[model samples]
Target chain A: MVCRVILPRQFRAPELFPQVQREFGRLERIPNHVQFDFSQLQFARPSGVVFLSNLTRYLRRNGCRVTYCGLDPSRDPIAYMDDSLFFEQHCGRRLLDSSQPRPTTRPLMEIRHTEVHGWIGFQLIPWLSASSGVPETELAEFRTCMSELFNNIQDHTEYDVGSVFAQWYPQEHKLEIVVADFGSGIPRTVRTVEAIDSDANAILRSFDEGFSAKSRPTNRGAGLHYLRQNVLDNLGGNLRVHSGSGVVRFEKNGNSHQVKLCEGSGFCPGTMVELEIRTDRIEFDEVNDGSFEW
Target chain B: MVVVVKDLVSSCDTNYDGMVVHKHVLSALHGTDSVVVDFSGIPNVTSSFVNCAFVALLQDFDFAQIRSRLHLQNVNRQIGNLVRDRMKKEAATVA
Candidate 1:
């Protein structure tokens, strides 16, 4: 039997998790062929692109005959994916037809880190700062936050490969970033080091300031905390993490921060982090009074 | 002796890159009583960068020695905070 899945019109993070879980559940029940219809997709963020890539890969690996259909070249729903090289790396082909003249410029970036040092420096920081109009110094905090996310995938997950898709919308004055990994999810990896009651708790524990799953000199466990601080506390951005059978969302609406946790009906094979930063809200001049002499 | 952070690493983002700079600092620390870590011209830094570059020093040296010997110069307030926070966390972890 063939299973058909219709893609969402606007696919971005925080909103994308429940839909992904629903679609994933539908795809799981099917025994054979699967068709992912993308005609309805109008706007897609980096998280959406990564999710599509990961989902496609997951389905294909599970012995299903997967076909992508209903993609409209005119609407350009796949622009972010195309710009990020999601189609090229994941599907071994380009998304845009050769005959179609490609748009000269787009704000999306796709980072696939094969090794550590070369990718993170000049190429990433300028793009993020320039697009967001945030000062390089303030953006540095975000750079550190993202770097830690990349490090987590490399150091903790069995799969060394990680993908990051980021896009800045000048009109909206917002930057959205998605970092993903196809490996053991957070719960499974954390369980390796300490006992965890559930995937949700494992995710919650990860946010605790100095919690790292690894032991001794190597495990600093400051990545997630820094991420939370920079995104939610510093930039007033929204953060969502989906892994295994749980999803956690941290959103800052004005002065109050709202956090929500839910158990997914379906399992995400790995971990995905989606963050949205409102560029206008970032404080470049903000400084901490606390100092470290040691 | 001064080890300009920008000269050591192109960008201060990841821990691995920080570790590379940390190695350089460790080597620099051996010969001199004090070493200056200048963040001049460096655009940005992360907690992981701070943790790997400076906070990890706690593994080998005492906090007081590191405090006395290592001088952070030209760093912005954010980088300063990140370094300090990572140091405190690392101190708590080690203790």
Candidate 2:
């Protein structure tokens, strides 16, 4: 039973039911169970859990046998396991495990570029998202997470050799992004600017607010910090970072956890960040129109 | 033709004169035997910037027109991907 994925304004606003209705129509003609991948959608302002609860009710009435593919839900199932009730209330019964078959590994996009500076990481994300059918809205946040790291590389390095290698494993159901540059790395960038003895501890603390080596018109070094809160804290994922030979890892699964400075390396000219994201919350959809918004 | 070296390419904010800079660079390549586009002053650029600027110029001026004459100096890795992605997307859409 092949599924027809509808995107953007193919359905109208103020309600997601129209999207369901169209899919049901297609199903009636084809006799195949329908799946709606809302992953590419960008709602003007989501009205919280009530709207989702109502959607569940409407789909049940139609015996649509529906399944949701894309929606960020903005909360992590692993991190927020305590409040399974909370997720059910807002996201309906089709939470984490029930969404789709989780992959042991997935086909990953590998981008090799030596000229884009820190962008290998950032650029890899869109291509991966687009190829994997990760919705643009969720993809935007994923890119933001990588941007925090990419921006750091761009600001801190003058490396002539740059490389970004990433893999999206299906069984792991995660996208692992690794970016490396042969520049000053994190220690030198911090030592020269902040006069602080550089180490993994310093880099860890630097993810906090007011911790930038450079000052811009509107930045507070909050990219890493924000990522910790949203993707790690809110999304139930893992962040592993190694810079200047120091390594620190953060993982959240219904609680915050970390493993620090367990290893060091001589690969100190630049930074390497590996971010693993589960595909359950990923919505692969076209970015052409408002089916999703950035 | 020597395109007046204005500024190197940057991010994809149309409000930031990046679009204008790109247009000027493209316009200078009217019928010149060879055109050199300098990016000495530019630091970084986004995929969208290359799409709206350089890739758009390529779209406007077919490959045969600018292939040999056009040269981008100080090409960064990020901008290269941006151009490549935009061109691929444009080509896919056109075909």
Candidate 3:
């Protein structure tokens, strides 16, 4: 049986997740082939691009033939997604007509599960700095944050692999990074160590300074907390985490931090983290502090 | 004895990258009075690296013993802060 999915018009986090969950459910039930129609997709956030790529990859891995149809180049006109080659690389074809020229320049860096290693910082820092004009000092914080997120995938998730998509929009002065996995969601993982009532509460607890699902010795759960500190608190960025049927968003405004949480309309199989950093507002002084005696 | 962190761990991004070095350091501490983890050549590190390499020691060894027997030397401000922050947070959790 072939499953057909209609892409959402506004593809973004906290909103696009429910649609994705419903579509993913359809894909799960169908065995042979899957077709995704993107004619209705007018706009897509960085997270949406990554989500699509991940979903397509997941479907193909499960012995399903996937195809894309009804993507009108003129109507969609998503420059960032096009520039990033997310559609061509993931869907394995160009969306626009043959006459329309695709962007030759690649705007994003895609990392598969096998390529992640200790030298990832070296690979990411230069690309990020070149794209966003973020100084090496500021990029240092990002390197640490990325390492934590990727490490979580390796340690916490049962999936052997995960994918990360990152792009810096120089015109918009923003950096978008999305990391996703196809393993059990954060709430289910946390439940292995301690009982939790809801996925939303699990997500909230995951951000606590020392909350960890694993046992002692290897259970230092400071990764997400430090990510939140580096991105939202230090760089004044925005963070959204979608896992299972829960979503939590954190944004820094002026000197205050705002957090919002809600239940997803449908269930996401694993976890997706979307972070947006305002490159123009990132200050090195805020990141560079002197040595610590302790 | 002095253990150069850069010489021990080639990269500081992954968890096992740090955990392996932590094991080496733990072995060094078996016979020596103290082991100074020199961070002169290493440029940077993430919390995950530090957690596996240093903070996890809190679970195995007493904090007072770690303070006395394991010394961090030639560390940059960035890594120092990372280690200190993770140590402080883990300490609270363990307490």
2 or 3: which has the higher DockQ? 3
Q: What C-alpha lDDT do the candidate models reach, one value each?
A: 0.70, 0.48, 0.72
Candidate 1's docking class is acceptable
Chain A of candidate 1 gets a TM-score of 0.79
The predictions' CA RMSDs to the true structure, in order, are 4.0, 21.4, 3.6
Query: Comparing to the true complex, what docking class would candidate 3 get?
Result: acceptable
Best by the TM-score measure: 3
CAPRI-style quality class for the chain A–B interface of candidate 2: incorrect
lDDT of 2 by residue, A66-145 (tens): 45565565534222221223234334543555543123222111222333433533455455655566543455445545
Badly placed stretches (over 4 Å) of model 2 are A1-127, A215-219, A257-259, A263-267, A282-294, B1-95
User: Tens-digit lDDT track for model 1 on A1-294?
Assistant: 777878778875445556656755634454477787878888876777777677666667788787878755556666655655655665566677552212322223334565433455565566666776676766766666676777676655665566666666688877777777777788877887789887888887888876887733566677787778778877768888888888888887677767788786456658888878887877766653323354
Q: Residue by residue across A1-294, what tens digits does model 3's lDDT show?
A: 777878778876555566656656624564578787877777777677777777777778898898877766666545456556766676565554343222222233456655765435566666667767676765667677777777776655677777666656677777777788867778887887878887888888888876887733565678888888889866668988888888888888778877888775666657888888777777665543343366
Of the candidates numbered 1 and 3, which has the greater TM-score value? 3
- Name the top lDDT candidate: 3
| Cα error of candidate 2 at position A114, Å | 10
Question: Which candidate number has the best DockQ?
Answer: 3
